[model samples]
Target: MDKKITNYIIYAVFIVLLFLSTLFKSFSTDVLWPKDQNAKGSFDGIIFSDPQDISGLNVTRTIFKENNKNLVKYDVSFLYEGDFGNLRILGNPVSQIFLPNKMNPVFSDVTLKGEYNKINNALFQENLKLKDLYKKVPDHEFSTTSKIRVPLDKEVPEVKFSMLYEPRQITHGLKGNIAQNAVFVTNARVESFRDTTKQEKGIKNESKNFQESGYYVNSIEVINEKQIKSISFESTLNSIVFIISLATAILLIWLDKNKSQVPLLISMMLSIMTVSRFLDKGATTFGILFIWTITGYLASLLSYAITSEENKIKTRDFKRSIAWTLIFLLVNIIVFIIPRTF
Candidate 1:
């Protein structure tokens, strides 16, 4: 076999192996970025609740990939006519996806699904007043409904709140999302607006809740940098590059009669890119970095050098590649460490 053709075949074979390994890593269930199929084994961020919230409290966030971006659809839940009514999602609203406005967020994705307990608007000839609405509806802890602000003369039926004394399993389907580094915050109070003593309770309670001990806020992380990167450049991008290079190498071996350096150059470039991506993430000790740098540089050089054009080694090129590899590896290590120090 001609040495040039053998080199192309061997390089194609190496890329084929890389493609196979990456295919496994990207598609395996245990690997990262599951539902985001377009970018499997990539950095698709995480959707999680705040650490302080016991059992994630009322926030239920599910992280999935959609349209090549990490989409988080979460149900921000609280008691009926309760905290979530005054909810405010405050943080870095950097995401270009579904984010709720700061004030009047309930209107963003409202789903009114509960009734007022012990209140009958049908019995009254005139529309129920706010006082009647408040006094007639008994307190029940389990009813879940979207908050609706009606005029003082509006009927309880107009509110369409499904309130009851009986316990019902809540399907907190009120969905909301925030971009990376943002939070879902709510100025929810522990008290209900069952106070019928003042007709102004509806207006006053919110202000009171905002000012007093009843003022409480809970935060749920919408998405953050700390999330497990499901699809990363190392895993998915390299896999793609490997596929493209493998195809090119096959074409060169079968069709291109001329001896070309493109195949070997691709192999070397890919090795450097793969090593760079690896060093971009994960904690790497000096030992790991040393082995990785040496392996990456030597493997690429040897892939071409062993089947040299004249069957001789390029010692200067090998040394230069080693020096450049070490420099880049050290630079990556520094870049990785500098951010964590702060």
Candidate 2:
């Protein structure tokens, strides 16, 4: 094959790979907030469950703002099939419930329903009118916990459980600063458990004693009209930065196709990506994209340095660079994207 033809082929492959990386990253669900003006917040979490005992699980979260306060509603549903004697479920601490400063819980309610012996039954239900449960913790922050119990029979082979709750949290100004319209962020930890106590039908036994558990987080966001507008504006600025940086990197490579220039181009790209992290707060997508870009650039630079001349780049150097770049890209996709995507 002609050396020039091989070099062109390598460039074409590089462009395709770059395009695919950008497209995939842009569509990643890791970006919690959408560019849409109506998007108020995002929810994402992993549910760890015993494959042998639990068959399926589903979780949903909803957020609402009323009376100048932000309220979060959570719905957790799951299916289990196993001997009741072997079943165990545990819950994590509900510390994330207190957010946007200390919040006096307007109300904390829990309702649990399940099926036993092929018959629909209300296993456990409770509505705690928690005026006294709400107490100030350290730092003068108010916190509360809701407890519910579901009585189960050991002979039952299959059970489906569903729980729902809504807790109203006060929306204070951003962390330390007080603003008229500030974005409120919080998360909920919902856990599934089985009754392990020898006793039957008690709130303390239901809430306090359990083992072998699975949990998930429901991230809540409450933003007013003005805060939503600010998010939209920031997103626009991020888009502009992304475009300019990408264009500049490509232009530099096209104008000066020398191995010596690769390092400078890579530095410029990294700087732009780092700046992107500040433009959008708490965004992991930018970090992931930056890592991917850096890996590719470093791999190409290494390959070029090993194969190229001091004064000029050759076709073989380009081909070798593409080979190493592809290897690095594969490693990145395996290490980062695979687990997140799956």
Candidate 3:
């Protein structure tokens, strides 16, 4: 057999193996923008009694599951009325209670089945209101819904909110074994009223409870940077990266029909890209920005260099590339450290 032919056969086999390896590898579960199939928004009304009130508090909190399917965006007028109690407002003032105006937008591709606790933990981390630890209610801590003001729209609209509550240290009169030092929210009323030219407060009946069955919001807008355009970019970049890498593989095979190395290189590129893509996805899903950014940058550069047509493999070039890569890695490390330094 000709040596060239044997090399070609070997490369073909290696390429095939690479493809198979990549095919078996698991992809990342991160939601890249618009790919959220289960994205949904809700306007929750939580009614419970203020824990500090003596007149028996009733509170209702509302949260909207802002999903991709829903076209409606939240407005500035959207107000969240917490159960009357001495609750610490995290970043914003109670008087200027607005939805997290600059909060990061989350993709809704993650599921809620069996991972309810994990999902809740993720939400708690992402949401500022939850971080405030608003009055820990004994055993039933999960019952009390934290009111979050999420941005639905840019328009500075005005909305009306009225509540009747008695601020009393709750759980005092409850029977024994009940959760201690409790706060209750009930009878919530949410209305989306428009300002008449005459400045009259119109009555709108859009109130609901948080505990009602089949009632839960999955997404909310917390930031302006989370515009639809940004979401689109994230989705497009992920796709383009994969496609370009695959195309490079195909091109290499075509150009070096007799060289077995071409096929092997293609397959290797595919495997690497697959792994990198999965890692990026996982990072995005878990909110590990530093890892995702650094990994993605490295993967992009390595893919280009490994598959580039300029086939001059000088030992010096290889060392220089390795050095540069290391430098970039160090840069990422420095970036990760800067935040902690402050």
Candidate 4:
């Protein structure tokens, strides 16, 4: 094959792989919101459930405090069946009963059995900063975790809890569920409310959608009041980062083809991928590049031993070059594990 053609093919392959992986991992590609639909609608709150338990709306239930402008509660119970007995759920701070006056939503109480435990507002705020549970929020408090641990030692792992929140928007009715990580809830009960609520409190059933009762929640809504006129700050920043990453990728590919700086190009591309992952999704731009530059350079020295040209640019070992490049590319693909395979 023509040398130029070979380079272009390699460039195209790398570009496609990186592009798809980034898009798959980046939620910021769309409007900067938690949920998919963007309109003025009251949010019924979102919960990030541990994927191990395979919890969904079918196994979950929700109920709201009967009072308005007070507290909104999520009554949830999970049937644990996974290795990680410690169930972890994080609430997206942007999507719930925030204080009527402030943009903050603080968890007032977390109940496991019947007893409610008080969590410090500051500690919860601090937890959001650490990515141990999830990503770091940019401007202010992003997400909060109100964990209710259901120990495996218990005879029956059927755990129940009521989480109270200040009413920002009234979310009632188990309108629907969103993936294994998130489930939305409303304030009112559904047709199966009686049997479901029998496990907890007595509630009336108004909806017609009936299922064999066992924790069926009612009422979840989306109010189309909060709408964005222009691109948000974070969204704008993400866009910029994306543009930079793409441009840098192109530049690195071009340089690699002409100058044959294989290790340098691979390292930089790896770095851009990490930085583009703003939420620390996997890693960062500089951090990833640094590791790649250091490690790939040191490892790729074998290429020199395979080449006889001492004049640097006099002769090209296209076959050896392709092998080393493919090796690095394959390593990255496997390491990052796309959809996050950047």
Better of 2 and 3 by lDDT: 2
What residue pairs clash in candidate 2, if any at all?
Answer: 89-193, 90-213
Could you estimate the TM-score for every candidate?
A: 0.31, 0.29, 0.31, 0.26
Candidate 4 lDDT, 1-342, residue by residue in tens: 544344445545544544444443332322222333322222233232343443432333333335332234455444445554333233433233312221123343352221011122222233212212112222222223343232332244444444454433222111111101112332213222221322212222222221112222233222222221121343456556656655665554455433445543554354344443453243333334344333334334422321212313222444555466566655665654342332
Model 1 Cα lDDT, one tens digit per residue, 177-273: 1112111223333222221112121121111112212223221222212121333333577566645654665555455443444454454545434
Give the local distance difference test score of model 4: 0.34
lDDT of 2 by residue, 1-342 (tens): 643344434444544554444444443322432223111211122222234454444444444345654343333344445443222222222233322222122332322221111110110111112211111111211112123223333344344433222332322111111111111111223344222222222211112211112222222212233443454465567677666655655454444454434553353334334343333332254445564555466436532532233423566756766665565556545654565654
How does model 2 fare in lDDT? 0.34
Task: List the candidate 1 regions with Cα displacement exceeding 4 Å.
Answer: 12-238, 245-263, 271-288, 327-331, 334-342
Q: Candidate 3: where are CA atoms >4 Å away?
A: 1-222, 225-228, 257-342
Question: What's the best-to-worst order under TM-score?
Answer: 1, 3, 2, 4
lDDT of each: 0.33, 0.34, 0.32, 0.34
